[model samples]
Target: MDMASVQLLPDDVLADILRRLGPHDLAVSRCVCKPWCAVIDARRMLPADAHLLPLSLAGFFTVSWTESLTAYFSRPCASIVVGKLDYLDTDDARSLSVADQCNGLVLLHRPTLWPDDQRVLNPVTRQWAKLPPYPHLVSPCMKQDSYQREDMYLVFDPSVSPHYEVFLFHSVPYNCYEVDVVDEDAFDPAVKKMEWPPSSYTLRVYSSKTRQWETKPFIREGEAAGTIGDMESALSPGHCHAAYWQRALYVHQHDFVIRMTLSNEKYKVIKLPLGLDVRTDDEPEHYLGKSEKGVYCALLYGNNRLGVRIWFLDEICGKMDWLLKRDINLGNLLANYPWKHGDRSWTTQYVNDEIGRSMTPAGAKFESDYSTNDNVIVPEYTVSLLGFHPYREIIFFRTSFGRAMAYQFNSSEIVDTGYLQGKGPHDCVGGSFAYTPCRMGKLSNNM
Candidate 1:
């Protein structure tokens, strides 16, 4: 049909036609014109697992090391929502990286900028808020290696409130310089060292409501994970991950999950269960995200079989508990997408690149434990969890063989979306953030 004819169609007829299309197409159809956008928004045509009108999964923004690029992978129809971010005051777009994502907004950071500049962006609406500079915390114990290892997390939930918050948590060195007065003229500079996981945590938080930065202190609720001397590996880059759910922020640190209740200003350290601990040599791939039920921890185990175990957080009793909700063997799913001929997984990186070599998964550990089926030639594939669907019961992940798949928890259905971006997938997706297209109003300064 011609453009004029399509525009002439009644609103009811247009809504019916648009409803037949998938979520991707509906998002693209909204960009066609004001009439179509209005009809879709008014009729609530998009697929929303919770609230209507403004929330739906668009795609993901991934930061891959191999490509040295922060790329957006989404359906061709909904690609427009993933803007170029031209509004930022930057000549080159490559200077910015997606630090974190929350709901429909993404926190962009420019490490090259002095004092570290960050901006919160809404890709769908192209509205952004420039955050004030982060407050500085000077540690009395200054070591050369203590370059102030820090992490930033974005929290935004439209279902609850419109204002967004950014949390900054950093590590402090062990020893501090203290003065001891033996007499009025004689004084001694005594060195005092504090242990890791301090009794209280003072964090820097930025709120859009006030358009300013404030420090919030959280008291520790339990035993410490370990001492500062033992956290060399844990505090390294790319070893930490954070998630926001149920009005609180859960950060993965060392062998425990740091639960920070924003409303109560209390933090608790919940040690991982025996097998789920990250301190082991054979660390299973796990990710923290929210699904349909609530906060979920997805772990991929290669011990006996290539299986996935999902744990649900049960907080009804006012205690931190991880209840195993689903455990499924992925042997059948892997069988369908066999490795290509003459294709092999890269077991190790080059010797010169020590960091990449350490990050690479140990190939021998993933050996199939299928002794019962001796005749079956099982294939070994390295799988990584990308992110979870913010509203639905799905987990998005990628395989070494260049495949992007989503597993539905309720139905145990695995959908092979396609190749990761294109064919011949690169195993460089270091991190991924789920992007939900939200067309809310402008992010105003006042709440």
Candidate 2:
């Protein structure tokens, strides 16, 4: 057979060739011919089980006016959107907000308002269900003539099954902080005891399949000084984690940095690393963001830099390690550039620095606009610390600001990946983007 003959090539052979191409080349190849594009779309031109499909690593970031939910590929410069969540819709609502993402599923919560009010579990896919109300206290024991007792309490156990359960912490008249989980299958809110204080109560798990909360009772406590307080102070809506690793549902506590494993209606709490503080002095706020592959915690810090940190729980050590990092440094990059309108004062020292560097005035103008920290001109997208090449290790972000930027780290220098300026309309607040992996066979002709 002639080696150059296309008809002699086997389907697997062509796919192997396509699998090696980059995303851009693959995209262009789709336009070469319909049959070729179809073959590529069918993914038949690539290996059936190759792992280099340009997987994404994503997280959430915030700016002045709106919150940014972003995603990027594992290669430094390749990031595209899979979703965008708006913060305005969730403010002050009883909903848990986006807590965390694991294997494409998110854990949501809804707190109680009244005695009969129930909590909720909502998946990002929009599937939702209600949990039973937390257990409340009944009449305390004493002589029949004793003054009317007035103590009530409630507790919460997310590990509960058929319905995630919570218990009232105190008996009435006194507020309690302790909650315990007794059964993993059926979470009962009716049990009561006068001697059990709020601080000593632990949550119990109830399993849906087993139809009971738990067979064995267990109590998990945090290292923090006080008992779990109001849900807001104790938990950041989007910072918590509920994931499945090793065939078990693992709930990660943001406040205590603890991981609890739920298996066979039993609960076990595992402590994570010591120095991981989700809140930093700079941004002082948190948001949840997701990508095609995993979830990440977003924080804002000094110099108006947006930092994203991805967490992976280590089952053996019972801790989470931070990986897949990206940072946007807008302050320093925009400093000393001339304002677009030329109305703002420009420092002589800064002007001299720009002149001495031979940077053209137009370049300086664009830089100034791009880097400006105006409260009103929120960033639509940020340059990833990675780079722009989809095949290279890259991370990129898109914002309501109508821009897409890329970044990469090369030894000591953090450089721009690629940038698309003015791609957004004036009033758009939320938008999403996705990346399609490139296969090598498609690039053979272009390369």
Candidate 3:
């Protein structure tokens, strides 16, 4: 056939090809033709399924006053903006007690003077509605002292069906942490109120569909008072794995691991490896992540402030194996600091040209220099191994400034996501947030 007579492929075919390319390549492909450019732009429209894709990378950039949650097409280098959720101008009276993200939905609890009084859930679209106060079973004996009781824990199970369940675990006057549940159905629009359950000594489970709080018979083997510290202790529950293979929820309790099936209400406790030496403390906090291989991993900062250790769990033998992946000894990096008090906080900056490096890893290094006007302090940080489009080897971490600094795996250079916008350093936040992939499917189109 003559070259001039050859039939051209449709725009959808070209668009699909472009979508498969890396972010950098996709940008170049968009310039191929007007039809291709239109298709590329349309594909940028995020679908809900994009948020549900397992193994996809997501970022949660939070500031003290505002939190910006963004999910990229893959990782940072791809530059494919999938979807974003913003929480701006929050009230100081109510603090963000808990942020549990699951299946593209985030449940944020804002505790009021009355325990479990005000809470909300924000899905991928940022649509939020007030949740009713959890039904509390106040003990008749402690009813008079309820105002003085302060110790509480907010537990959220995102995988729960019907409606997402939020459980309030608090000390009822003379007692320790007891469970109280809340969901959309519990809200009474007419009276704008929910009935609180009666205080009990045992753990209680509430069913949204049944609209009742049933007492859980299983007594967890632990010191209830010591397990949950002082009233004001920010004892946020650590990561709870809803294992796809086992179809159960695995929660780390102090020294033991608790497994509870989705169908059953009681938890089965199993002891972890004793020699692992995993510190369950405030500093060098421990976080959990699962690999595509179904291996459960834990990330913890080293005891000596040298680096982080990544622990892998062997499900076959129920053993824990760990590797010291990165050494972050900042002694050499901090020697240049002129401060004599050691009160000054130190942060690091990546070499700007290492944006696309394949082996460098994604995170900020420790730097003592703050003399330059461009240098700013980063309070908190988080790193993730993300799979961005075009190049699947990019990892990035966001600062409290609402900006994400990404690096290529091979190179140590840094690429700023806010470079094109010219935003300043005061954009980030001070706390850590969760990132989970949302699948791209028919549900996203309707949104």
TM-score of each: 0.70, 0.36, 0.47
lDDT of 2 at 71: 24
Model 3, 1-447: lDDT tens per residue? Answer: 222332275656644654566544454454455555555555554442232232334443222323322222133432223232233234432344433444344445543445453333343444444454455554333333234232222233222332333333333221122223212222224322211221123344444344445555443433232322222232223222222223444444333344444455544544433224545452343444334333243333343332333344555574434433333333332223232212221122111111312211112222222222225433233332221211133333443222344444345344554310112333333233344433321121123
Between candidates 2 and 3, which one is better according to lDDT? 3
Better of 1 and 3 by lDDT: 1
Query: Which candidate number maximizes lDDT?
Result: 1
Residue 199, candidate 2: how far off, in angstroms?
10
Q: Which stretches of candidate 3 lie over 4 Å from their true place?
A: 1-55, 61-98, 112-114, 117-122, 126-129, 137-163, 167-215, 218-246, 252-257, 269-283, 294-306, 317-431, 437-447
Ten contiguous residues minimizing lDDT sum, candidate 1? 178-187
lDDT of 2 at 206: 31
What TM-score does structure 1 among the candidates reach? 0.70
lDDT of each: 0.62, 0.31, 0.35
Error in Å for residue 369 of model 3? 6.8
**Candidate 3: what lDDT?**
0.35
For candidate 1, write residues 1-447 as lDDT tens digits. Answer: 545786789976866776676545565565566666656666673344122234467777776655434656564345343545556666655567787888778887764313377888887666787788897774334443335556788888665666789998775321221123111121112312244577788889998888889998899888777655444344232535677876889887655678899888998887655353333445566677777667778776665326677888888878779988778777776675432211232211221121222212233222223212422324555677778887788988776644567788889887655445321233556677877776542365222
Cα lDDT of model 2 by residue, 383-406, tens digit: 222212222333444332233334
Q: Model 2 residue 318 lDDT?
A: 46
Which candidate order results from sorting by lDDT in descending order? 1, 3, 2
